[model samples]
Target: MSPENNPSSGIVSQLESWAKRNINPLFSKDTWITLGEYIGLGRPVSNRPITTARELGSFVSSRSSHVAQSALYGYLKTRAGTRFPELFENPKMLASINLAKWHIYIACISDLAAYMGVLLHLRTGSDNDKVVRLMSRVVDDIVDEIGMPDEAGDDFHESVEALKIRIENMDFSMHEDGDAVFSVSPDALYKWSPIADELKRFDRTPVKNSVRFRWKDVRETARNLFDAQAVIESFGEPGSSGSA
Candidate 1:
């Protein structure tokens, strides 16, 4: 397909829109539904949390079309006890349970979108690509809101610079066995853990960092944007969902 007519052009716009909308501090439930649709996973039609990890995993597994599958499954499985311990341990609190599930669904979609962007970057290894550039902006916006300490600035810049070098260096190489390889090593991607780690810290923080990170919906969205790449990579390349 011609670059201008590529389906990804539209998908990039949709992904950009979703990223921008979710970055807002005050998103409604309807906004959540729209974000879900952007990821090719429609919003939950009902108000109940999936009662078990297996069910939650299955629900996400059915909806996913990219590399974020395993990470989503693992996040849903552990989120109840870790992120929303009160709601997870006490199923009797129907209101809280419903709210927690709603948050989880939103988180799953954000993470799915964020990781998909990362994989697209890794696949093409191009900083100039529309999708990768959009994803990079999303990452920068999320981290900026999280408010990194001044002392952490150098480390952050160094890590980011290293990641850039790695991305630029990605190209075909000959193996000893005479095989041509055109991919990134998993470890190379793992170096990006600093960004993902900072995102998770914000995700799990009890104190509100920003209006964007204060709300459960946006917080989850930020966390997902910086989620670990290796885990997301485990599910393999989940090619694009096609035009919108």
Candidate 2:
């Protein structure tokens, strides 16, 4: 199908295609073969020909990359913008920064990595909290996959604990609305229920009021694994992970 017609058209496909043609052939084209190189799975641990899912899970189960994660979140923001156009439009956001190689690696498994950027900046109180929790889940899976740094693990736990506090303490009521109006607070607020209100909201269906992010950053951020072409060889191997 044409890219335009494919509902699944995404940066992931682009990366896969590029990797299939550009990466060196030393690894050959195979799922177990490639992952085995990345982690060295089960044969003898010492003489093993394969790397268990747990070994590489951290890199394989997270967002594809920081840039791509942001792009995905930006896309989500756009999806949300369709409903809350005013709030999402020109979304002023604080982008999320990845602290560990684990963060970038996990993008291989979950799309949540791509949304990290949005999580950092997109503010919608309870909804944003939900997104953060989901991303945290992705992070947790990554931790399970690779295990955490010995001393740093404690700090990591503390940080996530702090996130929990933020999520739990968030004021869902920060936003106020009425049958005929809605207003987002802190920086701004406004409500509209009629066609006129919506019309007034969008002077030109501006992408500004709606946040849009790019995935190229993700591609760049993941250049290391971007060279992995083995995913193409396996196609849909159950264990092979990819970002959207």
Global lDDT of each candidate: 0.34, 0.32
For every model in order, what is the number of clashing pairs? Answer: 1, 30
Query: Between which residue pairs do clashes occur in model 1?
Result: 66-238
lDDT (10s digit) by residue, model 1, range 64-143:
22222222223333433322222223445433323333333323334333334444445444343444334333333333
Model 2, C-alpha of 41: deviation from truth (Å): 19
lDDT of 2 by residue, 1-244 (tens): 9877743343334434544565443232333233232222222212221122222223324333332333333433344442321221222311111232233223222332333313222332335454444444445555564555452333445444443344334433342221111111100111211123455355323322321122333333433333223322222223444231
Reference-based lDDT, residue 83, model 2: 33
User: For each candidate, what TM-score against the reference?
Assistant: 0.23, 0.24
